[model samples]
Target chain A: MIKTYLGIDVGSISTKGVLITENREIIAHAYLRTQGQPIEAIKNLIKELFKDNKNIEIKGVGTTGSARRLAGVIVGADVIKNEIITHAVAATYFYPETRTIIEIGGQDSKIILLKDSVPVDFAMNTVCAAGTGSFLEHQAIRLGIPIEEFGDYALRAKKAATIAGRCTVFAESDMIHKTQLGIPIEEIIRGLCEAIVRNYLGTVAKGKDIQPLILFQGGVAANIGVKTAFERALGIEVIVPQHFLIMGAIGAAFIAQDYTQKTKSTKFIGENLLDINFKTKTFECRDCTNFCEVIETYKNTQIIDRYGDRCGKWSEKLPNII
Target chain B: MKVAFPYLGYDTIALKKFVELLGAESCLGPPLTARTLSLGTKYSPELICLPFKITLGNFIEALEAGADTLLMAAGARKCRFGYYHYLQENILKKIDNRHCFYAISQYTPYEFFFKKMPQIFGVTPQKVIYATWLLLHYSALIDYFRKLIRLTRAYNFYDAQKKELEALRIIENVSSFKEVQKAKKELRKIFSPIINTSNEIIRIGLVGEIYLMLEPFANYEIEKELGKLGVLVVSKRSLYRHLKHLLKLDLFDLRTISNAYKYLKDSPGGEAIKTVGEAHIFAKKNIDGIIHIYPFTCMPENIAYEALQKLARDYEIPILSISIDEHTSKTGLLTRLEAFVEVVKRKKFKG
Candidate 1:
């Protein structure tokens, strides 16, 4: 029997899962759209990753991302960590000499500056979604270009046209105006890519050291156009890891491996939980002026988890696995 | 006469007591809610700072509650705070012309105690002095209560919260200087059972604009949330200290200015010097991290942010600077804080 661990990353836009061995070798991986339903996506993700690998003895489990706590409770994870540390851990693990990390996901863009394999500083895009995968996708759809082929158009342009990128509303109007002025489609696409790179540097990566050995990952790493723009802007080479999309899941598996080594046991319920009747209910808690909307998760008629209260009056009822 | 002032977190009670003792009925604005922010935003300029909008909301609510007079603290230089009252009053006048509006200008002790407050309240100068003195002492006592609660919360959060309310009740009704010290001692006793010292706790210092630091509604009750996360938050910026600084009696403020001089040569604007100063002090204390919070679009805090980057580099400590506004989402804020705390915790354990 193969001794393996499970890692699940349920982000805002996508869900990714991986099964890895004791030596940190990925045996199986799956990626699927969360589609605003993280629990369903996670269950389907587990089903896909575990295909024909039933003989594998899962030793541990971990979860990360925006819905990390929900994923943790569903899968009974051995380790639950945020995406920042998880991404940093996986990046530094693969590239020991990495100095900076530029991660642009579906809705969030973050720059993590590392010194000697430790995250010395980090900043994320706050109050702005002007430059992100979702914005790029929205623009792509409006321009009649598939997101997968959007980067190819940018590479084909001879000279990029200028477009406003400080805000999505301005960027959209600029793109429409350029199109109305009969500008080449490729040049406008390239300009949008450059605009995103400029916006990221001006806001999220502002004042941070952008040294060499930079690794650019997250869902947006697939865009060769963005990679080129980053290189052009920073005057430094950017490298995307082989598993850029699943790096966060891999990190979770690595963290779970580290955790179970100490605890000597895994909290993973089993290899398959698709058959379990999982349900979640939410209600507004009016106990205080801060009217928190509390969430309760149930499994087969038994309450498993409750959270989302600021006062912890409901969350603390069930002691955490930690 | 019925009097009202904008809320300043837990110091509202202290202010209430001050007004009541001045031979007037104290009418507090409604507790800050979503409606307060909405009302303020609706009546305010598009680009005004958050304090203005919130204070305007407080005044509006207080007026609705039959408050006859509204007092706002004024007088600042190199900052927009000094201009909030002038704009707010104009908006309020358009809303309703009958209510009395006043800006109690700072940096004028003689005019404040001898002329302004006495004339407003129909009180003697000696009475005003006594009331102001009690206000200072009440805040000092409340600040002490907060310190004990923070220490206790880091170790025992639930108990700290339970005892905090009980202790505040004992604190709010203290009528004399004799009661102040006795009340503080009682607060200590109430929280003593939960105040366990542990080297394992995470220490974070909070520094930012004075309004955001004092108003829980403005910054979203950051101290309590951090404490619940088992973080020992050290925030020294309070009304108690501000009063001392105004009186030219705070030796600590003198040291803060010198420390701030290491990075900022001169004040760029509001709270910039103090924010940089407090952050530098926190880094020197070798805490786990420093959380810098200020309203979005604040100029001085923005200037201080640049200095803090260098400070973070020099000290090699994690600094989380959060720019808050009405639109700042709760989930997004919580996510950042949790991630930061986890990173800081790992750094400590790994070292």
Candidate 2:
């Protein structure tokens, strides 16, 4: 019987899952909107993936993304990884020679530099949204172009109108001014795409020495206009992999595979985790100078995980509780 | 008279020469140890930066080692560092280690060598200056040779530096700037091409708390250790750069000077901000890495670190945050440094 490893990446906007077989082939995958409840989103994902095959046993599970710890606790993940490592693993797996990863999601953008499939330098933007998917989505709404039509409209434009892209505020104002000039919608869309690439280069990708074999992923990978815009700005080919949107999930699955192979024991909590009633509680522990606010996760009166403590005061108490 | 300096991050290999020139019996507190940290924490304010605590610890340890006179570097400028001498002096007085203190103030090092130290200790300025000059010459010679060797080739330059500096510290009868310059020339000529190579290096700037930056043991021999990986490190206390900034702050009123200057105009504390601001410029020039060193309780650096993080974010430069205290492990800092350098190297390769 072929055992599959499950990987879950829960972002603020989306939840992604990938089931990889023993040989690292994608057996089943799911990409769904998170809609704010990560636990419910993951549960729905699990249900959807298992609907067709109930006999497929999950040998290992890994979680990544912003809500990784939460998702880890929810799905009984065997390993947890950060965005940089997870993304780099997946990108390296896809493009073995990938030297750079330019990932632009809805809320954030990250630039990971790799040398021979290993990550060496990396930077991420958490403050601004000028070069991310949300910026394009907002513009698509303003232009009355269906979000799905954004890339095609940009491809139709012959020229791009110069627009300020320092931030969403400046970009929006510039877009309105360009629109008032009666510029063609396609040109404006093209300009927006170009502006996004320009903003990313000038800001988050600034000072970094970017090399070839670049892999651009994230939800925005669906936008061909952005891809074209990046190529024009960088003067290099940008490769968007087939599993761009679910790369993080794929990376998580890869990590799980690596971990499970190293440690023969399966620490998975089994599918019964789906039926477990999990609850959370928060309290302040002022035992030291650092008054840490610790949160405890309970599975029907039994504590399972503890976090949010600056010191390990509360979490240290968990083993005894368990 | 026996004199001692608290080994904060300043290149003590250089200071040892200065001490020899003064004909002073000198000893450095062991490269900031856990015991030193405990002593400092026991006596100092909890909120004060870790560097200050470690320094106070070093001072106490030196005093216990029978040091009667301490060479305290005094700065009366904008940053809290300006008050370090006064605060330390007062605290030491309270602790009653009232041994005599010789201050290296805003006055030139020559003034201290020729007049101030002699006036305070009743030694002839000429003899003291002569001895001091010889010590400084050899010290500078050692430093020049070490830097030359380290910068040029791929070898354990630290061992070479320590060996050369140790040799320089033994020479006597050095006086006057010209003699020191001559000694440097001789040392450089002998070590030139041999020290200078084909090493693909990324020069990194280590800026932040004095303790973590100076003590390789505290930060786990970070700079020298990184050198093992073919990375060149530029710390804030470099003589040429620190002097240039100090002179600019004094002679010409430059716009966008260090914020510490606002508080400690003619003091060591002011140099803290100047050093940080200078580092930002180095980062702009695209230094491979900038590790902002700070102690767990450092207030000024906390403010500076926050601002620097934003700058790094906007500039898209990689920065590793290293916060050290008594509880810090060498292994932990090493892990982060390796991870950070690895990331930076990877980025550069891709670029």
Candidate 3:
């Protein structure tokens, strides 16, 4: 059987999983909406991946994204890394000369500066949604356009309208006002695409070096209008990698491949996890004044993981893993 | 008189002891909590800094707890902290007219020790002098314990936390100078065993507003959070160091001040000078990063934030500036801290 690595990226808005051979060739992949339920999404993703690549023997597994810790526990990942490191590693793997990475995910955006195939500097948006894919999705729905076609509308604009990019509230109101002024729909869409690019540059990528060989990845990279806007704003061509949407998952697979090679074993629980009944329960721990909200995941009524306790009163009870 | 003071981190115990030594019942406001912050925010101007709001809450709680007299530190060279007492007194008097409030200037220690304190407590100058000396010693003990806790918490968090609680209990029970000396030895004994000299830890410098630097509650126990991330925190601002600097007993580091001149030629009031100066120093010392914290609506620290950002770029040192207020969530703060620790670790690895 060919050795393979599995990578799962469970983000707030979506869950993506990828299966790769030892040669770093993609064997199978699945993407599904998390819809606020990461465990269910991961299960579905795993089942989908297994349906296509049943013969491949999983040697290692890794997880990344906001819900990485939760995904790692469910999958028994050999490596659990943050999105910043995983994205950087995957970008370098695909484009070795990549100097900068611009990632606009569902709810957040980040800019990574790399030197010699290693991330030297990085910054993420702090409590801002003006420059993310979700913001554009929301605008698309409000304008009665499918999010998938929002970029095509932007590309057809005769002249891009200018919208405030500093805040989502301001930008939305400005977009509405421009529409009321009878600005063309295509122009308004293009304006929003530019606004997102401008906001991302002004906030997340602010004061950082944005050099050549810049790769834009994540959910927002599918928007050709935003891609063009980024190119126009920076006066440099921004390349969106082939596996743009699944780059985080691919990066995680690379990490798992490296880790399992060194350890000579994997902690992966295998495709049987698809059939396991995983339940999550959350309660506020009032033992201390902090009143931390503790989340516990149980597999078939057996507690497998506990987290979110600041004092570690609950998490410390479980055997350490990941 | 039943005297009380605002809780300023661990130094509250020392202040409480000082009040008790002056032949008065020491009533500290309830330890800062969510209730205190809410109470403070309710009565404070929406645009004022966090320290003002929290201290206002402390005075209100103390008065409600039947404390007849409230002692609040009064003035500084630059910053709205100087006017905090004046505004708090007005606000408290408006809320209730039964309590007596005194504004003790932190900058004028001699006048405060010999004149203001003696008059308020109706004590002799000699007794006041002795109490002040004892307060200084207690402050030093607390500062030493803070440093020790920061160091040990990085390696063994629970043990350091337990030891810190024990140290606080010792500090609270000490009355005489002899007891203070004994308490110091006992604290050393409690903390000595937890010292693990591991060279594999990252060192971070914390700088910003005096209140945020000294008060864990205000900054969401950031030093402890960093410690949990295996970071050795070196904070230059503390109540003990502030007291020494105010008294002119501690020699000013001219080198740090000169380093600040490269970024900020003059003090912009508050702790801006120290914030910038310390960032330069931390960069020179090759520290992992600097976490700059200040209250929302703080002008001096806002200026310092800009200078620190420039310094961060120039030296390639990562700096995380956190503006805290009543609405600052613990999870949000922790996320930023985790991301920052990752960044610092990656930078260290590359270097």
lDDT score at residue B89, model 2, on the 0-100 scale: 84
In candidate 3, list every pair of residues with a backbone clash: none
**Which ten contiguous residues of candidate 2 chain B have the minimum total lDDT?**
B247-256
Task: Judging by DockQ against the true structure, name the best candidate.
Answer: 1
TM-score of each: 0.97, 0.57, 0.93
Residue B288 local lDDT, model 1: 87
Model 3 misplacement above 4 A: A320-322, B178-181
In order, the first chain's TM-score in every candidate is 0.97, 0.92, 0.98
What global local distance difference test value does model 3 have? 0.86
lDDT ranking of the models:
1, 3, 2
Per residue, candidate 2 scores C-alpha lDDT tens digits across A50-79 of 877677878888988777877887777888
TM-score (C-alpha, index-matched) for candidate 1: 0.97
Off by over 4 Å in 2: A284-292, A319-322, B1-351
Worst 10 residues of 1 chain A by lDDT: A313-322
